[model samples]
Target: MAHIPIEAVPYLESAIYLPMLLIVLEKDYELIEHGQFKLKRPYVHLIEEAKKLAQRDLQDVKAYLKSHYLKVVQGERDELFTEYHFHYKQILEVRRYSNIRLRNRVEELLNLYLNKASQAHSAIQ
Candidate 1:
């Protein structure tokens, strides 16, 4: 097993899961829009802002990966664990993450990004 660079771990993980987060946010936005909520504007705005932030962060992550000549490739996956190949220069490190862990990490990231967006919105007011 090749050693994975510590600095690249977060970027690699984000590159894998941020797209999943965006899809989840999009669906949640649609659901909130159509759901029976008297005050939907706040919810909608938060999701919109969070989505924008996530997208921007994802682009930055991609740029970082490109500049560092790093790549993550999805490998075999099962219900419990998903496999990924992290390539940096001549090193190819294989990692397996549990599905539950991935879900939890994304949820945590969503809350974090949402809070950041909320703070930004509050600051503007």
Candidate 2:
């Protein structure tokens, strides 16, 4: 796997992405619990689903960040990002009713990183 730069992740909060992330993570956990991880087709399909969801959620987050940062923070010159330290908080609390799947996290991160890198590269171009 290619390395992702630390700063590229943005100092964003987890709650922004946590709920959607949990969905993907839960699905992955189910697959593991059922012992279906050996099937390449199922594995691939789960990864695809996770990637699609992550992409959609990330887009929402990007839009929210743009609007919120501009309207509330930049326009008003608020220091919330500094005082509250938004990055450290759990953006969304995982309801433990469902188990978390490790594979889902890997796939989600992979897709998120790749998409971000592509966006950054295109922006530079």
Candidate 3:
């Protein structure tokens, strides 16, 4: 008896398929036919898990984008600074490190928001 390698299990599962056609003569088995190949059976579960993880990451990113927009409008300078400090690399990359005009425009908008929030806060006190 030969011991089967565990690593070969995935390969075997991937190759496993329903025979489309079988030609048998007299009682002895003849040809076994199959169809187009696809990913291993075990990998289907893993693929689904990976898709869920990707969707979760995308949702987190979207939430962050929306929160950033709202925070700017609310004049949360401290929070904005913290967020930008953590994501400076991403910011630079997204803006392509070009277009000084755009950068300045972003700064102006943030400042405007912050001032408005501060004024509103002071009025409440």
Candidate 2 residue-pair clash tally: 3
Better of 1 and 2 by TM-score: 1
lDDT of 3: 0.30
Score candidate 1 by TM-score against the native: 0.92
Our model 2 lands, by Cα RMSD against the true structure, at: 15.2
Write down the TM-score of every candidate.
Answer: 0.92, 0.32, 0.27
Query: After superposing candidate 3, which stretches have Cα over 4 Å from the reference?
Result: 1-35, 70-94, 97-125
Determine the C-alpha RMSD for candidate 1 after optimal superposition of all C-alphas. 1.5
Instruction: Identify the runs in model 1 with alpha carbons over 4 angstroms from their true place.
Output: none
lDDT over C-alpha atoms for residue 20 of model 3: 8
Summarize candidate 2's per-residue lDDT along 1-125 as a digit string, tens digits.
33323432342333334444656656665666577456666454455555555666666666655544411111111223211123212232112211134335545675674465456555666
- What are the lDDT figures for the candidates, one per model? 0.93, 0.45, 0.30
Which model is ahead, 1 or 3, in terms of lDDT?
Answer: 1
| Model 1 C-alpha lDDT per residue in residues 1-125, reported as the tens digit of each score | 66767989999999999998999999999999999999999999999999999999999999999999899999999989999999999999889999999999899989988998899899999
Q: How many clashing residue pairs, candidate 1?
A: 0
